[model samples]
Target: MALSSTQTDHLRRVDAIGDPPARPTLVPAERYHSPAFAQLEVERMWPRVWQVACTVDHVAEPGDYFEYRCGPYSVLIVHGDDGVLRAFQNACRHRGNALCTGAGSSLRELKCGYHGWTWDLAGALKRIPNRKGFGTVHMSEFPLAPVQVDTWERLVFVNLDTSAMPLADYLEAVPTDIAWCGLGDFRCYATMTIAVDANWKTIADGYSETYHVQTLHPELHRCMDDVYAPQMIWGHTGKSESLYGVPSPRLSGALSDEEVWDAYVYTQGPLMGVAEGTPFPRDQQGAGQSVADVIAAQIKQFAAGRGVDIDWATTDQVMRLHQYNVFPNMTFLASADHLTVMTSLPGPDPDRGELVMTLMTRMPAQAPRTRPADVHMSAADAHPGVVMSQDIAVLTGLQRGMHQPGFTHLVLSSEERRIINMHRNLERYLDLPEAERISEAAAGG
Candidate 1:
């Protein structure tokens, strides 16, 4: 689809934001605390973009369903008896009462609390409590409004606009890139959601850089590498992949040949050596050599090769933390053995929002291969109530601080530029005149 003249102008405006400067800073007050900006975002951005709902794991069986909120809008995902997953506005057509309450479940019909109006799983109005007073009422035209719903891998997604472009087009190359990370096979071992005092962007920005690992998480620093670099893949739907290469142990400290060999054998066993079929040496690191020492040596070698100076002793790499901010409102984190998906929903109060995190994995019975108990991984935790507490503290604080007169803009590093890019994309969507920015992109746009 050819871009409308208005959309073309919008794109030009985005390009004018410039290739992004070296030190782009955002005004904390405008973005974090301004109620005006939040309302504008809800109007311009929330409805037009694709947002994650949940995963197939949560509603795998027919009649299974889940409910999600986007701004003031409530949505229900229903798996009909015919095995099709559909989304509907959680409201009745008669008096605009909420239709389905709580999370969705197997049911012959959904009855409203305010009035006895009922809808079938397919969203068709099946009954009205009193037919006598509504002699001329047309139920056919009053069926629930439908929303766009689709799936990628096993995750469910919904868009408020019924005419929006197909989900596949919006996703672009992201699916293939995630496959490269072996995400399709990853099982959810644990999941967490914490309320933050800062904006949703703040939560995302915090995870984008490893600059905080050394200071914020001293214990994790001791076990991981210090150099955290992210590679950006740009498009309508983009991705940023961060790589943390494990350092070899021999370089960290002076070690006897026996101890060095043993250290290499033990630490590398699960990661590099096992795939190579190397035997585990008896004395992996010398009696005097610590895991930290081996890691330091590995880091030095890598930095030397890249002409960069960073410490491995103070870095963390085993968890291979990855945050995939899928455009609009969904972000996924992939650890070495688990995956967590976080979805942001707009709130009635612009300052407050709802976030849902879902963890998924293959059932043990469904797996063809069997591993020993020591090697077996556990399921991911989906309840993020605790982790969210820590996030809420910082986010709320930041949001409040944005109200200060001294706060103006945020300075960002080249490494942290992705956050700015995200904001730019958001601006592009939100700035479009109400009519020009349609719900779905045309086929070829």
Candidate 2:
């Protein structure tokens, strides 16, 4: 499942490393905590951009539905009885009541609880309570307001702008770049909605760069190559690739091979079904095999136990994590046998947001799909994983720091270009005036 040499060459052409800007990018701090700015985003940005709503597993069978909410917008994604997937504005036409609340299966129709206004799974208006009250009501004229819905691999995305570009087009070269990994074979088994006290961008920026790996994620730093992890930017989407199962060059040869293995086991043991304190398999190390090769072998063996065949995946394919960012609020980190998609949604205020992680596991091609278990928890109670938990724990202080009177703007480096690219796309969507747009910081003497 590894990329061919030709494909790797193509990837090199898209790599954005060694392309640093003339100076640092300066983004206003108010964009993180200003209600006015958040309102502008809600009005102009959130509706038009493509966002990951749920996985196809959440709505595989007919009558299944998942309600996706962001800021003031709510979208109802449904699998119709006609075997087609569709989305609506999640509001009843009559009294503007929500047609659905949470995720569930076996939904015959969407009926407003407050009023009896009903619609079929296809979003066609079906009936209304006491129809005589409104004499001029027309069924065809009042179908549930449609929203655009599409799929790439197993992830479902929605856009309120029906005229928006197709999902494949919006994704640019990302789908093709990652096509060798067999992404569709991984099925989401669970999702955790962790409530955090930070702006959605605050949560998203955490995953957009590797600059914090050494400081904020000491354990992850011991295992991943923070440096030499190249990035790519293609319009609304971007990518970052970090090779795991190796000591970071930052450590400067201080970590032994066994130490690297231990770090990997501590930070991501579940991927290979290894326990936290498990020692490296010194005996299983082949004549010329490296720690990465040993780890890849273990992962393949683990997948085999679940009837998922990843023997075709090379060490590079399994150890190099392909982290992708879809502008605004979504990032999915994937390897040959591992996948985790995360999205940050605006909360009640600019200083609050929800980090939703859709966890996936590789399964046999013939394996049956099931609805993912969706659970909500506060940042304090969310221990999804060692690395991710650390990411969530820092949001509280980061949000508060953004409000400091002296903290005018966030200075960025070329390493954090993904975050800068997000702001670039965001400005285009919000149509911010020149004074409000992100700019280059003054050059240092």
Candidate 3:
């Protein structure tokens, strides 16, 4: 397959990761189900690395608050009356009761439900039920334990380690890589948290590569050129770009333009307001325009209807999906008029995890902000999209497969380097012994 002009430029601009290993990469299967390893992640990785807690929309107005939980750790994010965003350890200073449970607006103060201890929106201890009962209890002495909080584009992120690097630095080159997409213009309208019976890494690995599209996502394969998809790595962050609205080059036969259109509609017609079984508008194709060009035009029209101007975007910009993966368990894919952010959080045990999806749409500048509708569902009830549903359906089996006695390690190809990069980052944080680190097997061994 030949690389497009934009793809050529993308390859030339960034410092690519090292070439594919000479043989299959091996990762231990026990990491997926080991209780001790999970504990290590909870202590070392979750507390130290920056993670997307919620979207700015979730806490857009003063007094709005959202609770983010990973494993047993909970962080409460609040929009203060002073026009500042703040996060705390979500524990009351007195008796260690949770100050808040879920998310809502119009919060006057952080009041503990159990003992009636309270704090101001800025996290300063303001009131105590009985001042005389406690000896020398200074309000200033016991403010809420602070957590580092910041925003990138419209997504809010929190880090328990106050000394961790700024979110911008932690993201490496990802921010500058997709600045052309104007991510700030996209407004999150909803989020879905689906409970899955799979390890968090199992859920995350599904998004880290395109290697499964040919077999697992046939409809997606017909609309995306997975073979020519290129990737780049930058320390804790990396990205993959795949052109859509075309048939996969791996397909044996040439598909007609209408066939390609149907595949795209079946996979992601909602993006352009197209209904299922909608036929391609043959008349819509102008001279020298390909199927991708027509799809890009339709997307532009959809954006204009919402008062969002994407006229400056070219076909390549709108048709290519840029996927960025943040270490541990965060991945977001964006195009000129689309954005979806996903994250996986560890559940009660190593065999369980939750996949949270943040759905966004491009909106006109100065669009009124509203709190996003957040919903939680079991895996059986989740139907985020055709492609996403497919991804979710395989998690349980993939997780259970790792526990088989004969399944010792996962053999990975270079196409899955993003997943490999995640393990590399995990090793740095967990300080795994040399014996547990990943290695490449010698060819034909």
By summed lDDT, the worst window of 10 consecutive residues in model 1 runs over: 370-379
Error of 1 at 87 (Å): 0.3
Q: What local distance difference test score does each model get?
A: 0.56, 0.90, 0.90
TM-score of each: 0.70, 0.95, 0.96
Compared with the true structure, what per-residue lDDT tens digits does model 3 show for residues 335-410?
Answer: 9998999999999999999999999988888889977999999999988889999999999899999999999999
Ranking by lDDT: 3, 2, 1
Q: Could you tally the backbone clashes for each prediction? A: 43, 0, 0
What C-alpha RMSD separates each model from the true structure?
A: 13.0, 3.2, 2.4
Question: Candidate 1: lDDT of 330?
Answer: 72
lDDT (Cα, 0-100) at 172 in candidate 2: 95
Q: Which stretches of candidate 2 lie above 4 Å from their native place?
A: 1-17
Give the deviation of candidate 2 from the true structure as CA RMSD: 3.2
